[model samples]
Target: MSTQTTQTTQPMRTTQTWRLDQRIRVTGGEVAARVLGEGPPVVLVHGTPAWSYLWRDVAPLLARRHTVYVWDLLGFGDSRTDPGAAPSIARQARTLAELVAHWDLDAPALVGHDIGGGTVIRAHLVEHVPASHIALVDAAVLGPWNTPFTEHQQQHADVYRTMPPDIFGDLVAARFRTATHRALTPESAAAYLAPWAGSEGQRRWLDQVAAVSFEDTREAVARLGEISVPTLVLWGEQDQWIPLSTGERLAAAIPGARTATVPDAGHFVAEDNPADTAAALLRFLA
Candidate 1:
């Protein structure tokens, strides 16, 4: 897994492409992540039911001036997940600690989305992982997540446990272009869903989501300030995933964290507005 992976490029061309090249086996499970560009390490951790593809645009853009690394958590993308392994925030943080250690990353900056934010926060809290900086988009951390899931969402999650693979895959793929991120082009939509299609990895994602306990997530949210790193908070003003008020509270809670509301964007901030998202990130990471 040490070999470099040449990633895909199209309308938004990178100087080059890198495949899902690196592999790190941690605690009896293998974690797969892709490394691209050349400079200091920046790890991008994707949120629920998504892989590194979530950062396709931001990865290449930042790679223009810095090293970019995107990884599939053990239960998502091409990464391996043990069926019996715990999928809680604490467990995922341990897995993340394994990832940073295996790569020998010293003080690597991290960008985490959705559930990934909670993962990184817990890693900082319990593992004391060094941080150059951290950026959280939408409602990644668990606080205020008690807002009700739509009836459609509840039905869908229930259907997922037993849905046919092809149809279920289509549903997963469709999430990239839902009413959430209206600015996504067809190509961009297809690219994000590509990795989750027809893979056992997708099933593991469903498993993890089904196992989530709202109460436990709330408990984890209470421990967030254990994260001492400088933090940047970006919220989509139009985001339906979580309210903007939550983002305000999140920023105020974390020392030195700042919040920027991207107008007209949703939870998938980088896709709907790549330039704004990247610019905001570059400024914070600077």
Candidate 2:
């Protein structure tokens, strides 16, 4: 495993500034990560088509009371983009476990969104990674998690893989728009889009989409009852991709799991309502 550090500034659209200044080599590839604040460790994992930038608003809030670590999953953000690297949920879970060991974190609280939800779950349950607490935000835990857009891209990978860069970027932006109840600021949109621009970015984006499979979640869902750590199932009341019902089911499956809902938010609850999301997390983590 190799490590690198680079100081780069992201365009400040909001008060939060996301800088992926640290890179750590993991099983799949080097993952870009940022560490901030000081206290108990809290790792924020982002979902599909998004990198650590997704936590720009929420990480700082959580960092105020906890040592927060945010990292881009392999093949996303500034991480190594080897087309051969498989960013499958199962592989991502293992990569996360590897990160936990590399950081020497003992049972850090985990917050995950979208496919990231699935990653944390699998890492804890299947990979036997320990965590003091787990929070699932609009997670893709239940099976049949694919949306029409993802299905289309999965079925027509070749077409999307070779689509014009401009068109592909627009498509990604449109997907991001749908993920939130409110529109993303131009700067926020650009930050999210930066990782998926150009030919290589387009192919890497499609590769992750194509790698999506229910089998990964199916394995974890079947073993949900085995989750011993305190769990929080949080959802966006307006989530269109994964309904609130899935979140409810997930909460029910985990023993003593608490539930929280962010109104007027879509799948990306952090982006939609970071305040409520952070508050719910703070309460649970405390």
Candidate 3:
């Protein structure tokens, strides 16, 4: 594994060991990305409302054995973006595809969570991004992904955008807490909530919420069999966002794909069970 002498930084409100940080240009703006280790490439992609911080624990450990690259999706984390733009799954997937080419990661393994899982799949199916392997953890690729809350936000986007900072902060914090089987520590909660804590952040939060759409996912789900790379589907047994049954269906849909469950975990399996998640990934990568 590689090491940098620079002190750890808190760009997204957490201790990150990743270095070689740079802004890679994409469609609308640049996306923040970092690379670690020096072996076969492994890309960690996160979904909405989260940045590369989602894989803080898993990245370094994986880096010990392989090159690990993590990045924040456009409009989230330290990545520059347009606050007025609505979220588009196709756009995020295109960004991921472009990054893979820009990084020159030939046949890199992709591990994605939440909408990230969908992003990688869309990149493979629609954008034809070459991937050696894919692992979906509590992914939103299967269907019926948009929740009532997300639907309401899309419906009342104007009102949600004007919500008070404190009110929006509290609402997001509450939702993130319930995302995991275990309670998030105050520090961790604050770190995850940091991005959307201020006035400007509140507006971005509304934009992020309004951007949520399942239309692209619906299209990708229908073509799951088209993916030829080896794939693994990992899900939190107790995930409230995307259920275990969805994981099972996903595994079955993909050719020769296998499924596993992280016990006592919710949608945020890495946060709840990093060790098990890492172990599962190591086995698949091997």
Ranking by TM-score: 2, 3, 1
What TM-score fits each model?
0.81, 0.93, 0.92
List per-candidate RMSD values in Å: 4.5, 2.4, 3.8
Off by over 4 Å in 1: 1-18, 144-159, 166-174, 194-202, 214-220
Q: List where candidate 3 sits over 4 angstroms from the true fold.
A: 1-20, 82-85
Per-residue accuracy of model 1 over 242-272 as CA lDDT, tens digit each:
7788888888878778888787787777667
Of 2 and 3, the candidate ranking higher by TM-score: 2
How well is each residue in 166-261 modelled by candidate 3, as lDDT tens digits?
887788888898788999877667667877778878877777776667788877888998888899999988898877898998899999998999
Question: Each candidate: what lDDT?
Answer: 0.69, 0.85, 0.81
Q: Candidates ranked by lDDT, best first?
A: 2, 3, 1
| Model 2 Cα lDDT, one tens digit per residue, 1-286 | 4434455566423224567777677768878788989999999999987888888888889989999999888877877745477889998898889888888899999888999999999999899889999999899888888899999988888898778989988888788888888888887888878777788778788888988898998988999988888989999999988988988988999999999999878888888888988888999999
lDDT of 1 at 86: 56
Q: What is the lDDT of residue 24 in candidate 3?
A: 73
User: Clashes in model 2: which pairs?
Assistant: none
